[model samples]
Target: MLLAGCAGAPPAPAERPAAEPAPPPVAAVPGVGVEERDWLPPLFSGVEDEAHYYISRLPDRRFVTTYGGEEHPRPWYIAAERLGQIGEPAIPLLAARLESSDEYELMLALYALMLASQDPSLMAATGGDTLELGSVLDPRHNAENLALARAWWQRQGWRWE
Candidate 1:
């Protein structure tokens, strides 16, 4: 059904639609550096915008979370994965996350800190009163993981209790 344009006066001047301005193009991230879109910020600047977004956004709702206990692989495993990508920038977040009650999350954070031990700030984080963790670095309890931690410590020239 054709609707008549006004029979009265000249048809209203054909309206010109306003043109949308194009958004500013972003500069590409350097090749040596991590791609901005590829990682959460600092790890990949201008990417995720916030630090630890990768770790934070993981499925914490899972019945088996990264914070240890009966769960075979906790949600914090992803945090551990992202931790390796973050380098020294991940130190503060990992350090802060270490304070949580979840042993899995806390252990993952500690493990990440071990990987990023080159940063001096990590020393202070490791020097805390009591660490919530999966297993201590004592060989008597869990020999394999303890050995791994010991090796990691020796690599970083760090001593943990």
Candidate 2:
């Protein structure tokens, strides 16, 4: 009777076969500029503001050194992307990297340039404003705008000298 009672106890609810390793826990770290809950290294301490912080932060000489340390780049090219988000702050470093960079790194610099300027370089060229490449590198239409920057910089009222 005891064995019968135990067997009938709902067959112990069929231990729900080990679930597909529940996805990694979302980081509890508070975000500063944007909600980058995942993809960040566990050791990375960042603010979630989306504007005041994040990769958009200004880059100094240190940026050159820092950007290179992250070598396994097939993923967060965005950090290299931070190069673009940081804008002119990123230019010197980006240009330097571009000088000797692999095809992928140049792509990152180009993407960053697109991000930091000319959100719509077209609109800016038409005179409504200017493109912030840091804001638009990921778009498909940037080639035209980049050409514009190269071709028309003199007319924009600044001498290369």
Candidate 3:
């Protein structure tokens, strides 16, 4: 007896959807630096909008000031404050900042993570105090501390502590 179950026709291949067009680039003002244009809010915006402008610029590592307050803390401090204010959304960015080569950036990122998480214990686990972290130029210590902090965050699975 001949088996009639074998199919003669192969199934047609699935068609892929067409790629969508890319969105237009954000318009930057002429003569303004790219970082400035991106982070500096258009003049006359509210304070919160202005705060966001500075917050958005944190990754640049160049912008160091935002309007307001007599203290005028360093740019890194401003970035940390903003990141802390941003909370969980800032974690991955702060985590990525953990890899920064600049000492200030690395410290700021770690501090930001701590502040954003509202956990002082994280600093202790990082193997140094804020002073040591900010002052130590020893790459070895820095790398080790960074590794410890990064490992902690990794172990925590990057969730807020």
Candidate 4:
């Protein structure tokens, strides 16, 4: 009789399906492509705001160097360093800028991403060994770098926390 009661009792609740992993986060800015004019500069007034200031100045290509170890006056380099110092908080912003059509903006964003994440893979993917101002400026190198960057972002950007 107890066995019959046990049989009559409802089967244990079906095991809940495992929760799906959450989708990766997207960039704050919507458009995947760049705009006609530089969009990042107007976000901040000046140096008073560190992140915005650096982000705004990232496209400035006034001075650049052939290699990393050597010092350069490029505002983009300084901005990349500053943004790197800002760390994870800067990832999404830099990620957004990766969509930029402007080569400088895109490259600067990639450089900042390399710094902010400190991921050797990103460095490796984006030509860390050959990276330089000239390589960034060269059309062939730029396309290669951009392709690698976009691929990296697709694969790892969302999971980069």
lDDT of all the models against the reference?
Answer: 0.47, 0.41, 0.56, 0.59
Instruction: Please give the range of 10 consecutive residues that has the lowest summed lDDT in model 4.
Output: 30-39
**TM-scores across all candidates?**
0.36, 0.33, 0.43, 0.47
Best by lDDT: 4
Model 3 residue 78 CA deviation in Å: 1.2
Whole-model alpha-carbon lDDT for candidate 2: 0.41
Candidate 2 residue runs with Cα over 4 Å from true position: 1-76, 118-161
Error of 4 at 59 (Å): 1.4
Residue-wise C-alpha lDDT for candidate 4, range 29-114, written one tens digit per residue: 32211221243444544334656667877787742333333475322356676677665567677777876888777777777766
Candidate 3 error regions (>4 Å): 1-56, 59-62, 65-76, 119-141, 158-161
Model 4 scores a C-alpha lDDT of 0.59
TM-score of 4: 0.47
Candidate 4 backbone collisions, by pair: none
Q: Give stretches of model 1 more than 4 Å off.
A: 1-50, 57-76, 118-161
lDDT of 2 by residue, 27-73 (tens): 46442123233434446333223323334322322333222235742
Task: Indicate the worst ten consecutive residues by lDDT in candidate 3.
Answer: 129-138
Model 1 collision count: 6
Q: After superposition, how far is residue 105 of candidate 4 from its true place, in Å?
A: 2.0
Per-residue lDDT for 1-161 in model 3, tens only?
98777486777789889989999987765434443455445573554554455445555656554444457732334556666665555666667677777776676666666665553554455443322233232344566667666665766543444
